[model samples]
Target: AITQAEISVQELATHSGQIEASNKALDDIAKQINMFALNATIEASRTGNNGQGFSVIANEISKMSRSSHEMLGKVTSSLFRVKEKIDATTAVFATSHAEASRGVELGSGLTDIFEDLLEKANAANDSLGSINESIQSQFSSLANIQNSSEELATVAEKNAASANMVASVTEETAAAVEYVTRSAMELTRISESLSQSIPTAKMFDEWQPDDSNEKASQ
Candidate 1:
């Protein structure tokens, strides 16, 4: 648009000058023809035979100047049209430039919004990653607890068997103590005749007391 405006403005200025130059050329032609007319009049009076052709030539020059004037008028009218078109086009160019600038401003705003959204998206992604990591840690902890519980169950089974064995040993020890007590009671009943069970003191063969045994007895 700027280029168009520059071209149009240059064209209008250049064409206006052409109109002026055309008018100047026509005016100069008219002046030259007028001088020729005066010269022809004087020559016709002084040399009647030679002046007829000079008069005709002067008339042709006048006619050509009139034609030039008519052409100049046409050129001037066309220049006015060109100037009006250029002015209108220049206004259009100015309006278009304004609209384009507004578009640029809108584009800038959209770019800012896009940048903000990108940042928010990145933040959300980071938060999600943190949450995912926390979930993973919790899962691992639960797995460890499950493993410990399995070991505890195994230990409990072993402890139950040990408790059963200890109960059996306790019953056997109680029975042995009861047997020992019964034997002690039986021994108390037969203890007074216990020495007669030994036969070592009896004289199996017609035993007579020797003189030394009698003395000892005394």
Candidate 2:
């Protein structure tokens, strides 16, 4: 848009040049007309009273030329002002174009930076996803380990119970062996006392002094 405005301003400057040229041509024409009027007045004076009407016509022509010159001057001044404004407008457009171009370059740079940041963000998201998966896998493995540990604990508890049962049976067997040993000692003492008491019964013993006493002594 700025470029188009600059072009338009340049075209206006060209038109102003053309208008100034035309104004100069008009001024030249006015000068020629004024000179012709002066010459006509000189000829009218040379021709005396009969040239009075001709002299008045010459004066009117001169006055018209002067008016035309004054108008042309005003036009020239206006064209100068218009040219100055056009030049100023053209400068402003040129500056605006430069600024706009710079702004576009900055915008493009910002876009590239934003794209790079977006790519990095996506990569970060992918990395986080991978990390989350890894953590889940580790949790699964830990769960399996915990389950195995619980199974081992159960087996250990069963083995401990079986060991406690065996220890109780062994204690009962020891108690029974101690009772049998005591009974054997008491029986031996009773047999020795009977051997001594039987001698007091000599008469009966003699009557029965057969293999009984011999077997007992043997």
Candidate 3:
């Protein structure tokens, strides 16, 4: 989605360039038309009686040229503002994409930690099982071994709880990333529609975990 938004921005920039060029051309044409109208009026005045109709035509042409010039000026101004806004929006999207990428990275790292924690928990549980067998075989050593087993079991239980917490957090982060993705997609769609409507006038034809982010966000 970020990539698509960037492409849309580039395309918008291209269209802006086209608009600027067209506006410049229109300004030049309007100037020439005004000059022609002025010359025609002067010549018509010199022609006396026969020049009355020519004078009217020259006046109308002058009025039309002025109107067109004003209209083109307004359009150019509007397009400039639009271009500025699109540039700002592109910057914002770029920042958001970066933040979202970082979030995915963090989420992935957290998932790795969870895996490691679970592995350690399983190892402690297995050692505790072995200690139980030892206690059964060596009654004289039961007191010492029992204390060690209790401590190991406690550590294993705490680790299991921690792992569960980490899993819950990972799930939440995944959902957040998914939400961001959907939002980005919606924004891209909006920009695309806006770009399409732009040429009509011319008629020319983020923020959050590594594992959750990497898997769910994409």
Off by over 4 Å in 1: 1-49, 103-218
lDDT of 3 by residue, 57-161 (tens): 445545544554454455445445555554454444444446556553534643443344334323433433442332233232222322332332333333443
Best by lDDT: 3
Candidates ranked by lDDT: 3, 2, 1
Q: Model 1 over residues 1-218: C-alpha lDDT tens digits?
A: 23432343344344334434443543443344334334333433443454344344334434433443343344334334433433443344334335444443334543343344334323433433443343334234323323332332333233453333323332332342243233223322222122121112121111221234334445
lDDT of each: 0.35, 0.39, 0.41
What TM-score does each of the candidates earn?
A: 0.32, 0.42, 0.44
What is the Å distance of residue 20 in model 2 from its true position? 3.4
- Better by TM-score, candidate 2 or 1: 2
Which segments of model 2 are wrong by more than 4 Å?
1-4, 104-218
TM-score of 1: 0.32
Give the Å shift of residue 143 in candidate 2. 99
Error of 3 at 38 (Å): 1.7
Clashing pairs in 2: none
Ranking 1 against 3 by TM-score, winner: 3
